[model samples]
Target chain A: MSMDFGGLRAVDRLDLMIHRGEIVALIGPNGAGKTTFFNCITGLYTPTEGDIHIHPPGGGSKRINGLKPNRVTELGLARTFQNIRLFQQMTVLENVMIGRHCRLRSGIAGAVFRPPHTVSEERQAAMDSYRILEKIGLESFVNDLAKNLPYGAQRRLEIARALATEPFLLLLDEPAAGMNPHETHELDQLILRLRETENVSILLIEHDMKLVMSLSDRIYVMDYGRKIAEGAPGRIKNDPVVIKAYLGEEYVA
Target chain B: MTPLIEIRKSVLVSIWFMFLTFPIMVIRVNTVENVVEWRWHNMIAIGAGSFLLSFVWRYMIRRKEQGIRRQREGAGPRLSIFQRIGQERRIFLPALTLLAVAVVVFPFLVSMYQVNIMTTAFMYIMLGLGLNIVVGVAGLLDLGYVAFYAVGAYTYALLNHHFGLNFWVCLPIGAALGAGFGILLGFPVLRLRGDYLAIVTLGFGEIIRLVLENWNEFSFGPSGISNIPRPGLFGVAFSLEAHARYIYFIVVALAVFTIFMVNRLQNSRIGRAWLALREDEIACQAMGVDKTRTKLTAFALGATWAGLAGVIFAAKTTFINPASFTIWESINILCIVVLGGMGSITGVVLGALVLVLLPEYLRAFAEYRILTFGVVLVLMMVFRPGGIVSNVRRTYQFEGPDSGDK
Candidate 1:
C-alpha cells in the first residue's frame, strides 16, 4: 500500500503480512511510516494506491482498501492506538464491552425490551470481556474508569479491550511505548500468551529495541517510509543495512 | 496562587459583572403606556447587587478551600455534609422513594391548575430525556429538537383535523413521522459537529416553524388546528378536573416508559457505542461502531419520545399553534436536561420538576419571577456546572480487593 499526503509520500508501497498465530513486529525510526502503514491497513486512511486484504480464519480474503474503519474491524481486524484511545470516562469493562459491539445483534427494539436473547447475549459479552480482562490481569480494575488506571495498567487495558473484539489480526500501536522494564516484561509475556491461548495473530509497531528483539518471531525494519530489511531477529540484528540505518554499526553487538 | 492574584481575579470578576448588567438592568418597561424608559437607580441597584453577589461567592469559595485544607490536616470532617449524603445509600434511597411517592400522589392532593402544571412538567421531563439521548449520551449538540416536537404535534393535529383520526391512531403515526424527520435532519448534519451542528439544527427548527406558519392550507396559517380530540380510555372520555388527572396519568406512564427505555438504551451495546462516540468519535469507529448509524439512532431515539410527548401535549391542551413549538421551547427542554445533569434520567426528571414547578411556586412574585429565575439559573451554572443530578459513572459490583485508586 502507498499513501501520499499532498506531495509528500507517508507510506511508499508497503507490503506487510501477518500469518495466523504469529507475532510480527514492525520497527522503524520516528516518521518512518509505521503508524501510517497501520492506519492504511486499519482503514483510518485510504491508501492512495494498492489494496489491503484480510484473511479471516473461517473465510476468504477480500480487498479492504476503502472500507470504513468500523467495517474493517467487523472483518476480523482490530487495533489499538499509539496514544492510548481508551474511553476515559467509561469503566474498563464498559470499554471492553464496546469492543463487543460489532459481534452483538441487539438493536433499539431488543435493547429497549431486552428479550431473553438480548439479555443472554449482553451477559455473554460481559462474561467474555471479563475473561479477557482476567487474561490481561486487569480483572481487578474492571469497574474502575479507564482514565484512572495507572499508566502500565491503562496500556494493558487497551490490549484487553482490543482482545475483546475477537479479532483474527490484532494491530497494537506502541503497546510498550511508555512502560518501564517490569511492565515491558509483563507485556512480552502477555503478547506471547495471547498467540498461544487465543489463537490470534499479532502485528505491532514498537520503538523499544529490547522488547521488539525478545517478543517478535520475525522483525521487519523500515527507514524513511521504505522497508530496509525483514528476517528472523538473529539475521536482522547482524544485517549491515539495518545496523547502518537504525542501530548504528558499533551498537550492533 | 497568592492573595494578590486572588484580588486581581475578584476585580476582573467585578468588571465582568458591570459589563453584563449594564444593558438589561438599565432598561425599564413602562407598563402604563408600554414605553421604554431608562432607570439609572435600577442600574445602580443591579450593579451593586451583582458586585456583592460576586464577592460573596468568592469569599465562600475561599472559605471552602480553607475548610478543605483544615480537613486535610485532620482537623475536621474529610467530606462535606452534602457529599456524605450523596455517598451514603442509606440516606439517599429513602429520600428518592419519598420523592417518587410525592410525585405519584401529587395530583390527588393538588387542585386542577396545579395538576395541569404538573402535566406540562411531565411533558417537559419526557422531552428532556429525549434530548438527553442526543445531546448528553450521543454527544450531539442539537438546537432544532423543537422541530421534531413540531412534526409530531402537527402530524396529529393535521391528521385529526382533516382525516378525523383518534388520538391512539395518531400517536404512532406522529411518532413515526417524528423519527423520519429525525433521520432527515440527522443525515445532512452528520458531518457537522458541535457548534456547526447546533446552528443547522436551529435553522431546521426555524424552517419547520416558518413552513407551518406560511402554509395556511395545511397548518391553518398560525391559527393552528384547534378542537383537537382529547385521548380517551377505551371509549370513555374524561371530564373537567378528571381530564387533567387522566392526562396526568397518561403523561406519567409515558415518562415512565421513556425512563425505562432510555435507561436500557444507555446500558446496552448501542448505549456504550453512544458513550464511546461522545468520548472519542474516531476511537468509537475504530472499535467497530458505525458512526453514521449510531448518531442516527441517537437522533431517532431521542426524537421518538419528543414525538410521543408532542402527541400528548396536543391532546392535553386540545390545541397547538406554531408559537407553542418555538425555539424557546427547545431551549427550555435543553435547559432542563443540562440542569438535571446531562445523560442522567433521574436528573432530567428532577430538573423538569424544579424548573416547571419553581415558576408556579413563585407566581406570587408575578413580574419579578422571570428575573429571579434568571438569577437562579446563573447561580446554578456557577455553583454546579455539572448540573443538579450530574451523571455518576456506573460501576459494577466486583468482590475483589478495593484499592483507593480513584
Candidate 2:
C-alpha cells in the first residue's frame, strides 16, 4: 500500500502480510512510515495505490480500502494508538465498554425505555468489557478514571480496550516505547497470551530491539518508507541492509 | 509573581484598557446635535473600574494556582459543601421535602406575579436539561437552541391559530416538530464541532427569527399569534390565581418528566456513546460508533424537551412573538445549562433557580442585578470551571443476562 501527503510519499508501496495467529513485527527508523502503514491499512488513511483486504476466520476475504476507521474495526481489525488514546475522563470499564459499541445494537428508544433486549445487551457488554479487563489484570482499576491510571496500566488498558472489540488482527504501535524492562517483559507475555488464548493475530511496531527480537515470529525492516529486509528475527538481525539502515552494523551476529 | 510586580502589571492593564476604550468612552459624537461630547468622566470611571477590578483578578489567579498545586499534590478533589450535602442522604431528603412543600404552597405564599416567575424558572429548567444532552453529554456546542424553542412555541401558536388546536393536542405535535427541525439542523451541522458548530447554530437561530419577522403571511410577522389560550382543564374555569397555580403545576410536572427521561438517557448505551464521542471523536469512531447517528440522536432528543417547554411557555403567557425567541433567549438557556453543570440534572435545576429566581428577587436593585450576575459567572468560572455541580461519571454494576459467565 502507498500513502502520500501532498507531494511527500509517507508510505511508498509497502507490501506486508500477516497470517492467522502470528506475531509479526514491523521495525523501522523514525519517519520510516510504520504508523502511516498501520493507518493506511486500518482506514485512518486510504491507500493511494494498493488494496487492503481482511479475511476473518471462516469468512470470505473483502477489500476494506477507504472504509471509515470504525468500519474497519467492525470488519475484525482493531488497533491501539502509539500515544495512548484511551478516553481520559471515563472510567476504565466504560473505556472498554465503548470498544464494544460496534458489536452492540441499541438506539435511543432502547436507551430511554430499557427494553428487555437493551438490558440484556448492556449487561452482556459490561460483562464482556469486565472480562477483558480481568484477563489483562486491570480489573483492580475498573472504576478508576483512565487518566488516573499509572502509565503502564494506562498502556495495558489500551490493549484491553482494543481487545474488547474482538479483533481478528490486533495492531499495537510501539507498545513498549516507554515501559521498563519488567513492564515490557509482561507486555511480551500478554501479547503472546492474547494470541494463544484469544486466537488473534498480532502486528506490532516497536523500537525496543530486545523486546522485538524476543516477541516477533517474523520481522520486517524498513528505511526511508521502503522495506529493506524481511525474514525470521534471527536472519533479519544479521542482514547487512537491515544493519546499515536500522540495527547498527556492530550488532549484526 | 510578587505582589509588587502584580500591582505594576495591573496598572499597565488598567491603562491599556483605558486606551482601548478611548475612542468610544472619551469621545462620543452626538450625531443629531452635530457635536462631539467629550465625556472625561466616562474615561475616569473605566480607569478606576478596571484598576480596582485588576486587583480582584490577580487574587483570583493566585487562588486558582493554589488549587492546581493542591491537585498536583494529590490531595484529591475537595468536594464543595453543596456536594457534601448531596452525598449525605439525611440532609438531602429533608431538604428536598422542604423544597417540595415550599413549591406546593408557593402560590398561596406569594402573588400571581411571583408564581408566574417561578413557573418561567421551571420552564427554563426543562430547557437547560434539554440543551445539556447536546452540549454537555454529546459535547456538541449548539448556539441556535432557541430556534427549536421557537419551533415548539410557534408550533402551538400556528396550530391553534389555523386549526383551533388546544395546548394539550399541540404539545406532542410541537415536540415532534421540534425534533424534526433538530434533525434538519443536525444534517448540515453534523460534521462541524466546537466554535464552528456554535456559529452555524447561532446563524440558524437568527435565520428562524428573521424569517418569523419578515414572513408576514405565514407567521403574521412579529405581531405574533396571541390569545392562544392557556392550557385548560376539562371545560372548567378558574380564578386568575387558580389558573396561575394550575399552569405552575403543569410546568412542574413537565420539568419532573424532563428530569426523569434525561436522567435515564444519560446512563444508557447511547449516552455512553455520546460521552465517549465527547471525549474523543476519532477514538469513538474507531470504537465503531457511527458519529452521524450519535449526533443526530443527540440533536433530536435534546430538541424534544425544548419542544415540550415551548408549548407550556405559550400556554403560561397566553402570548408569544418573534421577540420572545431572540438570540438572548437562546443565550439564557445556554447559561442555565453551563452554570448549572452541563450533564448534571441537579446542577441544571439549581442553576435555573439561581439564575432565574435570583434576578427576579433582586429586582429591587435592577441596575446592579446584571453587574452582579456578570461578577458571579466570572467567579464561578474562576473557582469551579466545571459549573456549579459537575456531572459525576457513572459506573455500571456487572449483573446482566448471565451471571458469572465465562
Candidate 3:
C-alpha cells in the first residue's frame, strides 16, 4: 500500500508486503518521506491515494486508511513514537497498563464496585504488565515514574508499552535514534529477540544503516516519498539509487 | 541506633502521640467566650503532633529507600494483584468508612450553631469536589465555576420567589441552568489551554456576578432575593419547631452522595480519560480522546454538582443574594482542592472541612483568621506541594497479548 500527499507526492504510490514473523526496515535520506509513510500507516495521516491493508490473526484483511490512531491500534497494529511518548507522570507499569485499556472491560461501575470480573481482569492486566516489564529488564523500575528513567531506559519503556498493546504487527520509528553505539548494538539484539521469541512482525524506520542491515529481513528504500529501491538487505546495500539518496553514491560497493 | 536515627525515631513517636491526643485536648479546652485561647492549645498539640509525625515520616522515607535498594538487588517484593488491591483498599476504605460514620452522626452530636457551621463546610466540600473534577482530573482551570453556582442559586431563587415554585421543583431547574451555562462557557474557550483558559473563566465568573448585581429588574440587584423557601422532606419543613436537625441530616446526606459519585467517576473510564487529558492533551487526542466532548463533560458534571449545592445553600439560608457567589468564594474552593491534593477525594474533604470550620472554631481570632489561613496555605504549598497525602501512589501493569499480564 502507498500514500500521496497532494501534488508534492509526500508518499508516492509504492507496494510493500510484510509477512508474519519477518522484520522489515524502511530507510532513506532526510525528507525522504520515510516518516510520512509511517504516519500514513499509523493513521496519523490519511493516504490520499492508495489502500493499506492489515491482516488480523483470525484470517481477515481490514483497510486501515482514514482510521484514528487508537482505532488502528484496536485492529492489532501498535507503534512507538519517534520521540518517546510514554505517559511521563505515570509509573512505568501504569504506562504499559494503559496499552491494555482497549482489552479491559471494567467500566466505571465495575472499577468502583470491583466485582469478581473486574478483579480478575485487573489481576490479569497487572500480571501481563509485569511480564512485559520483566521481558524488557524493567521489572525493578515498575514503580518508578516514566520521566525518572534514564534516556535509554525511556526508549525501552516505550517499546515495552507498545508491546503491551498486544499488536500482531509493531511499527517502530527510529528506536535507536538517540542511542550510543553500545546501546544501539544491544537494541539490535533486542529487536531480533522480539521477532524470534514473540513471533510478531515488525516494520522499522531507521537511519542507522548498520543496525538496519543487521536486523531487517527485507529493506525498502525511499526518496522524496517514492520507493526508489526494494530488495534483500544485501542487494539494497549496493543499490545505486539507495546509496545516492541516503548513504551517498561514493559509499556504495 | 545512631544519634541521628535515634532523634528521628523519637520525633516520630512524639508526633504520633500528639496526633492521638489532639482532639482530646481540643474538647477539654474548648470554651464559648474565649475560642481564640483554643488556638494556643492547638499550637501546643500540633507541636507534639509534629514531633511524632516527623518520626514516622522519616521512618517511611527510610523504608522507601530500603525498598528501592532491595529492588536494585532483585529482592524487592514482586508485583502482585492481591498486594496492589490491598494497598489501595487500605488507603481508601478506612478513610471512606470514617467519613461515612461522621456524616451519619454529626447532626446528633452537634449544637445548632455547630450544625450551621457543618452545613457551610458541606457546601465547600461540594464546591471543592466539583472544581476538582475540572482542574484536578481534567486539568482544566476554570475560574468561572462560581458562575454555575450563581446560576443555580438565581434559578432557584427567581423561580421560587416570583412564581411560588417549591424548592424541590426548582432544584432540577437550577441544575439545568448551571449545565447550560457550563456548556456555553466551554464552547467559547474550547481552544484555550492552561493559564489562558483560567483567565477567560475568571472573566466569565466576574461577568456573571456583575450581571447579577446590575440587573436589578431580574435579580433584584445587590439587595438580593429574600423569602426563598427551604427544602422540605416529603412536604414537611425542617424548621426549628419541628425538626431542625433534619436539615443538617439532609446536608450530610447530600455531601455523602456527592462524595460517592465523585469517587465512582474518578475510577471510571471517563475518569481515566480526564486524567489522561490532564497528563497530556495532545497525547490524549492521539489516543482518540474526543478533546472537546471530554472537556464539556467535565464542565457539565462539575456544574451539575455546584448547582445541587446551590439548591441546598438556598434552602438552608432561606434567602439569596448576588453577594453570596463571588470570586473570593471561587478562590477559596480552589484553594481547598489544591491544599487537599489534586485528584485526591479524601484530601479535598479534609481540606474543605479544615478551611471552612477553622474560622468558625476560632471566632475570637476573627481579626487574625484570614491572616492565619493565608499563612497556613502558603506553608502547605512550600513544604508539601503534593498536599497532605503525597505518599499515595498508583501503579499499572501490562502482560503480553497472547499471555495476559496476570
Candidate 4:
C-alpha cells in the first residue's frame, strides 16, 4: 500500500501479510514510516493507492480501506500508538474496558436503565478485562489512573488494553521504547505468551534489535518509506542494505 | 521567598490593579447629567481588596504546587476532602441526611418569595447538572445549550396554547423535542472541538433565540406567551401560595431525579465512553467507540435534562419569551458546571447553590451579582482551577478468579 501526503510519500508501494498467529517485527530507521504503515492499516490514514484487507480466521477477506479507525477495530484490527495514546485520566480497568466497547452491544437505554442482559454483559466485559490485565501482568495497577503508571507499566497497559479488544491482529508501535532491559525481557515473554495463548498475530515496530531478534518469527526492514529487506532475523542482521541504512557496518556479520 | 519580598510583591499587585481600574472605577462620566464624576473612595476599596486578595492567591498557589510535588515524589497519594467523604460513608450519610431534611422543609419554612428563589436555584441546579454531562464528562464545550432550554420552554408554551396540554403531559414531549434539537446541533458540530466547538454552539444559541424572536407566526414574536397554566395536580385548583409550594416540590423531585440519573450514568458503560471521548477522540475511537454515536448521545442526553427543566420553568413563570433563553443563560449554566467541578454531580450542585443563591443574599444584590461572579471566577481560576470538587472514580475491588461479581 502507498500513502502520500502532498509531495511526500510516507509508505511506498509495499505489501505485507501476517498469518493467523505469526509474530512479525517491522524494523526501520526513524521516519522510515513503520508507524505510518500501521496507521494506514488501522484506517487512521487511507492508503492512496493500494487496498487493505483483513481475514479473521474463518471469516471472508474484507477490504478495510478508508474506513474510520473505530471500524477497523471492529474488523478485528487493534493498534497502540507510538507515543501511547491512552485515556490518561481514566483508571487501568476503564482503559481496558473501553477496548471491550466494540464487542458489546449497549446504547443509551442500556446504559441509563440497564437490563439484566446489559448488566451481565458489563460484568463479563469487566471480568474479561481483568483477566487480560492478569495475563499482561498489570492487575496490580488496575485501579490506578493511566497517567500515574510508571513508564513500563503504561506500555504494558496499552497492550493489555489492545488485548481486551480480542483482535485477530495486534499492532504495537515502539512498545519497548522507554523500557529498561529487564522490562524489555518481560515484554518479550508477554508478547510470546500472547501469541501462544491469545492466538493473535502481532506486528511490532521496535528499535531494540536484541528484543526484536528474540521475539520476532520474521523481520521486515525498511528505509525511507520502502521495504529494504524481508527475511529471518539472522539474514536481516547481515544484509548490506539494512547495515548501510540502519544497523552499522561493524555489527554486520 | 522572604516575608518582606512577599509583602512587596502584594503591594505591587495592588498598585497594578488600582492602575488597571483607575479609568473604569475611579472616573465615571455621567453622560445624561452632564457631569464627570470622580469617585476617589472606589480607588480605596479596590486597593484594599486587591492587597488582601493577593496574599490569599499566593498562599493557594503554593499549596497547589505542594500537592503536585507530593504526588510526584511518591509520597502516598492524598485524597481530596470530597474523596475522603465518599470513602467514609459515616461522614457522607449524615451530611446527606441533613441536606435532605433542609430540602424537604425549605419551602414550608421560607416565605413565598424565598421559596420561589429556592425553586429558581433548583432550576439552575438542574441546568448545571445537565450541562455537566456535556461540558464536564463528555468534554464537549456546547455553548448553545440554552437552545435546548428554549426548545423545552417553547414546547410547553405552544403546546399548551394550542392543544391546552398541561405541564405533566408536556414534560416528556418537551424533553424529547430538546433531545431532537440536541441531535440537530450535535450532527453539525461532531467534528469540531475546543474553541471552534464553543463558537458553533454560541452561534447555535443565537440562532435559537433569533428564531423565537422573529417567528411571529408561531412564537407570538417575543411578547411571549403568558397566563400559561401552572402544572396542575389531577386538575386540582390551588391558591398562588399553594401553587408556589406545589411547583417547589415538583422541581425538588425532578432535581433529585436528575442527580440520581447523572450519578448512575457517570458509572455506566456509556458514561465511561463519554469520559473516554472527553479525554482523547482518536484513542476513544481506536478503542472501538463509535465517535459519532458517543457525541450524539451526550448531546441528546444533556439536552434531555435541559428540556425537563425548561418545562418546569414555563409552568412556574406562567410566561415565556425569547429573552429568557438568551446566550447568557447558557454561560450561567456553563459557569456552574466549571466552577462547581466538571464531571462531579456534587460539585455542580454546590456550584449552582453558591453561584445562584449567594448573589441574592449579598448587599446591593442586583448591582453586585455580576461583579461578585467575575471576582469569584477569577479567584477560582487562580486557585482551585480544577474546580471546588474533583471527580473521584469508583473503584472495583479485585477478587480471585473463583469469586463472582461483588
Query: Among all windows of ten consecutive residues in candidate 2 chain B, which has the lowest summed lDDT?
Result: B397-406
Q: How are the candidates ranked when ordered by DockQ, highest leading? A: 4, 1, 2, 3
| Cα error, candidate 1, residue A102 (Å) | 1.9
Where does candidate 2 stray beyond 4 Å? A247-253, B1-68, B397-406
Q: Score the docking of each candidate (DockQ).
A: 0.53, 0.49, 0.22, 0.62
How many collisions between residues are there in candidate 2? 0
Lowest summed-lDDT stretch of 10 residues in model 4 chain A?
A244-253
Clash count per candidate? 0, 0, 20, 0
lDDT of 4 by residue, A7-91 (tens): 9998898888788899999999999989899888888788899998888987798999999999999888888878988999988
TM-score of model 1's chain A: 0.96
Report per-prediction Cα RMSD to one decimal: 4.6, 4.2, 9.3, 2.8
For model 4, how does the per-residue alpha-carbon lDDT over B160-267 read when each residue is reduced to its tens digit?
999999888999999999999999999999999999999999999999999999989989988999998899988788999989999999999999999988887877
Candidate closer to the true structure by TM-score (higher is better), 2 or 4:
4
Q: Which residue pairs collide in model 1, if any?
A: none
Against the true structure, what is each candidate's TM-score?
A: 0.88, 0.89, 0.74, 0.93
For candidate 1, write residues A1-253 as lDDT tens digits: 7899999998887778778888999998899999999898888899999888778888798999989999999988889999988899898888888998888889988888889998878777777787888899988888878897999999988888788778889999999988899999999999999989988899999989898898888999888888889989889888888888875678756
lDDT of 1 by residue, B257-351 (tens): 88888888887778889999999898888989999999999999889888888898899889899999889999998999899888877778889
Please name the candidate that would achieve the greatest DockQ relative to the true structure: 4
Judged by DockQ cut-offs, the docking class of candidate 3 is incorrect
What's the residue-level lDDT of B57 in candidate 4?
84
- lDDT score of residue A220 within candidate 2: 93
- The digit string of per-residue lDDT tens for model 2 on A95-138 reads 99999999999877887788999888887888889889989999
